[model samples]
Target: MPAPVSTASALPARALLACSRAYCAAAPRSSDICSSLEEQWAKIVLVIKYLGSKRTLVPLLTKLVEASGASTGLDLFTGTTRVAQAMKTLGMHVTSLDSASYSKVFGDTWIALDGETANHSELVDAISHLNSLTPAAGYFTQSFCIDSRYFQPFNGERVDVVREKIASDYSGTWLEAPLLASLILAADRVDSTTGVQMAYLKNWSHRSKHKLELNDPVLLAGQGLAVQGDAL
Candidate 1:
């Protein structure tokens, strides 16, 4: 009867080395892992702010995908679609799923949009105009920031104006996703939260005090699926 090998330290030196080598061999090579990480990081750099975003896990997830040699992927709880966007950037067909309307907009804009129909320069100009529009105290200002302080009242007013403009002018158009995503990202940039909307900081963050500005979303070129439904 052999003594029970209850711990890894009980293994013979040669057995330990062999196990280590086998583990390394089964894992993705260092270079492949690095490249995958870089690729995934690059994709999510453009994603809009969302609660529980998995942007930080992109590198680890990418390495796992490379090790598995998966050709396609699905992000079942694709909040803001950061992971799905990364998979699409890796040339894997991706399907993004989220129950929230805002997340669906992110997916449609960043992953599923057909950009050829709209002129890029025109969209940029439109965003620039929205950024320059004067802020006014409105619903968002009164509702979220003036009393609640979720954002500086000035920025919140600007958010309201831009949102109303988009709703009136770009509603149901191909430009809607890109334009709306731009606003959402801009608003997130100026929000006074510590990364979520459940509470606001007692004082405004410096970033929140700056004038709000919108940047064009980096739309990917490809056909993908954006589904909004319960994951369960």
Candidate 2:
């Protein structure tokens, strides 16, 4: 008889799909993933500071979805779209619904978001270009850096320039949503807020000092609809 295969996760509970190098699902709430969100099968990582993110529950959730034997599933309250992303990996037609605009980007990037598709390598190059642009002080810098303490002045300027470039070039196109999503993920790494974004810290957190960078968002191939609105 053939030897039994181990069903355990290859990476430890803390080792999750990282960005080209990217965020650790197991890392502290204060740090950012250095690379981009990239995953291979069971190795999925999404680092968002939400009190209700189900990222850690994905392993168990995947098992449940597998047992259901259903081809389609509905994630009515997709908070961070983590479960929905996992369900899609199971080859199920998944629908992720949330009321937040950023959720739409997550839905498009991980789920079946509407948008123009590009070659993966080309997308990488585009991300590189975004990173190369010179950062400038814009409304984002003044508001988030000076007015508020979400990010330091250095990283805030980086955020501003890159976002302005993306807005100018890809705004209103399918590319726009995912690109914005990518920026959000990158910025999340260096922000000073205490995860929920309700407010900033009295002092800059340890991770808030890192430079802002954009990385490739792990793109999943599956069928699903990203809905933005009231779940009701």
Best by TM-score: 2
Error of 2 at 93 (Å): 0.9
Candidate 2 — which residues are off by over 4 angstroms?
A: 1-49, 113-118, 195-197
Q: In candidate 1, what are the lDDT values of residues 41-140, reduced to their tens digit?
A: 4222212223455767889998888788888889998987888888887777788999999989998887787555557998898898888888878889
Once superposed on the true structure, which residue ranges of model 1 sit more than 4 Å away at CA?
Answer: 1-51, 115-118, 195-197
Per-candidate TM-scores read: 0.73, 0.75
- Reference-based lDDT, residue 165, model 1: 89
Report the CA-based lDDT of candidate 2 relative to the real structure. 0.72
